[model samples]
Target: MVNETMVTFQGWIGTDVTDRYVGEAVVASFRVASTPRKYNKLANGWVDGETNWYTVNAWRSLGRNCMEALKKGDAVVVHGRLSTQVYEDEEKRRFQTMVVEATSVGHDLNKGTSFFTKTTVGAGGEADDGALREFNAELGIGGPQISSDGQALGDFVTDEPSKEPAA
Candidate 1:
């Protein structure tokens, strides 16, 4: 959908990311609130304008990462396609809601600092075992498997499938 609109919001996470299984796929959903502020020169301070709330959803690996990394009140930037839903309440009043199917979500650097961990992707595919092993190594699995020569840990990992998992 080349015509799909791309939107980004700088906001605070309004809710902790909730992970659930939709069939076999994992999805993480959270809410974010973006409020505008204006300087009140006469008052010698800044005043809050309007606040907009959005629901953000991430799927698959991104969803899993969000579940692991995001918490309520964290400042973040969400980038995704803008989507909407309309429904009527029991009283027959119509209401519209907005959501973003996030392609990427990260902590807003303007508010504070954040550390990033690179996710491993293999030449074959994201589901490949090589990528999974690399991801585990990046987390320092097995308490640093450094060789005597001080080579980088996980250098011994190979694409070959082992008959038995390492103990």
Candidate 2:
């Protein structure tokens, strides 16, 4: 039998990322706060309610990216598996904590622009592809055209020069 689970949460960063070096690699960890709304029939229709906080850890490149781009109050969507562990504090208090091991993390649309609708344009200016590019060409939203080669956008996080091979 195969045991697999996927969980998603929308939340805001609780604090700044704390990154440290473990040998030659770096690990980044942070806390996120998620709030759920509940309907109250007493004297009001709905009220902002309880908030759930979770610790999130990102490994390697993802950790670096999260550390650089994420900050307090920034909204993000984290997708990954849930993990739990037991710990003993300095006071000898035993506690169990749940954390999420995020395999993929990204910015929330409500907070800022996401990579979902990302696009680029070519000199022909007719839109690289009708299916891919959505915004109007007149808007000048698209950047340089992406080559047909294996130059994936994931390889470049910034506007650096692309090293695309010949098709």
Candidate 3:
């Protein structure tokens, strides 16, 4: 990919994620919209600029995770290879779009908080409960009680309750 264009985008998910299988490989596609803002000294406020939209495609495990974790309106950051795709309609009109073949995609931490869960894939390329248990043991915590679908059934333990000033 020496000649490929690489870019990182920060934006809000503009559409619902579409997950589909092309043969044995899964791909998840979605639209992201990024709008720029600039401070206007004369206007004494910030001005909104035109939004740029990009189509993002995540492949394989990333695609599956995206399908489960992402939704419209969520703020996210995507890093990937960028390219333009052109298509001709039946009427011979041409349409062009910017696409990102995402290498990594995640929620924007500045917008909100997120919980992290490590997914361990076994030899057969499936979630491994045993591996999760081992990981939990290494962390000196009780083994995570996982459901058949791989979701943690045990409640998360927090160090302390949030101490905020009384309103």
Highest-TM-score candidate: 3
Write down the lDDT that model 1 would get. Answer: 0.81
Quote each prediction's TM-score.
Answer: 0.69, 0.63, 0.76
In model 1, the Cα lDDT at residue 135 comes to 50
Candidate 2 or 1, higher lDDT? 1
Local accuracy of candidate 1 as per-residue lDDT tens digits, 32-131: 9999899999999999989999989899888978887899999999999998979999999999988899999999999999987655434532433454
RMSD of 3: 9.9
Give the range of the ten consecutive residues with the poorest summed lDDT in model 2. Answer: 133-142
Candidate 1 residue runs with Cα over 4 Å from true position: 41-44, 121-167
Superposed Cα RMSD, model 2: 11.6
Q: Sorted on TM-score, highest at the top, how do the candidates line up?
A: 3, 1, 2
lDDT of 3 by residue, 117-160 (tens): 65655677655568666655664443345554566778446575
Error of 3 at 36 (Å): 1.4
> Candidate 2 residues 1-167, lDDT tens each?
15756679999998888988777556778999988778888957888778888889887666766776788888999987887878999999999876888888888987787444333444543224553334223323334433334253333245655456779
